[model samples]
Structure formats: structure tokens, C-alpha cells
Target: MTEPERRLWQIVRAGRLGFKFQRQVVLAPYIADFAARSERLVIEIDGETHGSDSAYDARRTADLEARGYRVLRFTNADVMTNPEGVARTILMALGRDPESPLSPTLSP
Candidate 1:
């Protein structure tokens, strides 16, 4: 993992801010960031490489979504600078109860 990936892993491993509410997973050989199985959320940390190939990223996102995963993207700067807010965003995304709330903050 790169430095930013390592840092985000640390934050996820901490289990604070309702992180423990879901199981955080790291998918290899295809994805490098984090994913929560219960919520079907995949978090991607974008770096300089992302700027060069947006079409590829869009395809990856589409593929993951096809597999029932809701992809949430964040730049490396966003993760490094404000991980807590990112965590909050993830929580908000996870908080949506499909059986109850129709319009949660971060549905997808």
C-alpha cells in the first residue's frame, strides 16, 4: 500500500465513528483502497494516476456497481487532509436503512 493507503487503513482499523458497524475489507489485484461488506461500499483514494485516465475509472466504477457495490470516490488530498469528515461521509452512506428511510444523506 502507498503512504496514503496505509494512513486510511489505520483510520479504518481504529473502528471509531461507527466504523465497526460494518466489516471493512481490502480487495486486491483489482482495488487497493477500502471496502465495507455490510454496506457494499467501496472507497477509492485517487492520486495523480486518476487524472490521466478517467475513462478507466468510470469503467471500474461501473463494473463494481454492477456487482452490487456502491462506489464512493475520494481524492488522496481529501483522505489525507480530512479523514474524519470522510469517515463521517461513509457513516452517512451506511446509515441509510432501505426498509425505512427513503432519502438518506448519502444513499449512494
Candidate 2:
């Protein structure tokens, strides 16, 4: 896992987001960075490589969506700089109440 992925995993694993997420999970042809299968949600952590592969990523995302999975992509910088915001976004994607105390917030 990348450093950003490792950091996000610290918050995502073990149902901490009100959903269980598995890291580096294989969704047939592609390996998702994090996935909550029950919710049909796949999170992809993209680095510099992704900047040059938007077309491929779009096709992959389309395929996953066709298979009933919603894909969310975040840049490594976003994860590193504001992980709490990422968590909040994930919680919202999972249909959780973002206003809940368990929701993550940016640290002072």
C-alpha cells in the first residue's frame, strides 16, 4: 500500500466508517484500493500514474459501475493532506449521517 493508502486504511478498516472495507480487493478484472462490497462501493487511491490514464480509468470506472459498483477516486495528496475530509466523503457515500460525532473532522 502507498503511504496515503496506509493512512486511510487506519480509519477505514474494521467498520470504522459504519461499513467494512477491504484493502486491495480484487473486483474481477481490477483491484480496488478499498471496497465495501455490501454497499457496492469501490474507492481508488490514485497517484501520479493516474494523471496520465484518465481514459483507462474512465473505462474501468464504467465497467465497475455497469457491475453495480460505485467508484470513488481520490488523489494521493487529498488523502495525505485531508484524510478526515476523505473519511467524511466516504461516510456520505455510504449514506451515513455526516453530522454524526463519529464523522471525521479536520484537526486544528
Candidate 3:
């Protein structure tokens, strides 16, 4: 894994996002950076190398989508500079994120 991948993994591993994430998941032809199998969500951390893989990346994403998986991608800079934002976006994509970061609502 790249440095960015390692960093993001620290945030999402061990059911941190309320879903168990596996690193370097094999989805047949391509390996995903991180995947929550039950949720069918794939998170890809793109590094400098991906600058030349745009077309390939698109095809990969399309194939994953066809197989009913939602793919989220983040650049290395995004992870290194704004990991919180990346985590928040990923949490939102999981479809269970709260609207605000405040404490959970209390029962009446």
C-alpha cells in the first residue's frame, strides 16, 4: 500500500466506519484499496501513479458499478492534507452518517 493508503486505512479499519474494511481486496481482475464487502462499497486511494491511469480507472470504476458496487476515490493529497474531510465523505457515502458532528440526539 502507498503512504496515503496506509494513512486512510488507519481511519477506516476495524469497523471504524461501522463497517469492516478489508485492505487490498481482490474484486477479480482488479484489487481495491479498501472494501466493505457487505456494503458493496469500494474506496480507492489514488497516488501520483494514477495520473496516467485515468482511462483505466474509469473502466475499472464502470465495471465495479456494473457489479453493484459504489466506488469512492481520493487523491493522495486529499488523504495527506485533509483526512477528516475524506473520512466524512466516506462516512456519508456509507449512508449512515449524521447530518452534524454534534453529540447524538437524546431520547425525550
Which pairs clash (backbone N, Cα, C closer than 3 Å) in model 3? none
- Full candidate order by lDDT, most accurate first: 2, 3, 1
lDDT of 3 by residue, 14-101 (tens): 7766788999999999999999999999999888999999999999999999999999999999999988778888878888664565
- Per-model TM-score, in order, reads 0.72, 0.92, 0.89
Superposed by TM-score, candidate 2 places the C-alpha of residue 52 at a distance from the truth, in angstroms, of 0.4
User: What is the C-alpha local distance difference test score of candidate 3?
Assistant: 0.85
State the displacement of the C-alpha of residue 12, model 1, in Å, after optimal TM-score superposition.
1.3
Clashes of 3: 0
User: lDDT tens digits, residues 5-72, model 1?
Assistant: 76666666545434443323545336536777666778888997899889988888888888888988
Summarize candidate 2's per-residue lDDT along 49-104 as a digit string, tens digits.
99999999999999999999999999999899888888888888999887887764
Ranking the candidates on TM-score from highest down gives 2, 3, 1
Q: Once all C-alphas are superposed, what RMSD does model 3 give against the true structure? A: 5.0
- Which candidate ranks first by TM-score, i.e. highest? 2
Off by over 4 Å in 3: 98-108
Instruction: Look at candidate 1 and tell me the lDDT of residue 93.
Output: 80
**Which scores greater on lDDT, model 2 or model 3?**
2
Q: What is the lDDT of candidate 2?
A: 0.88
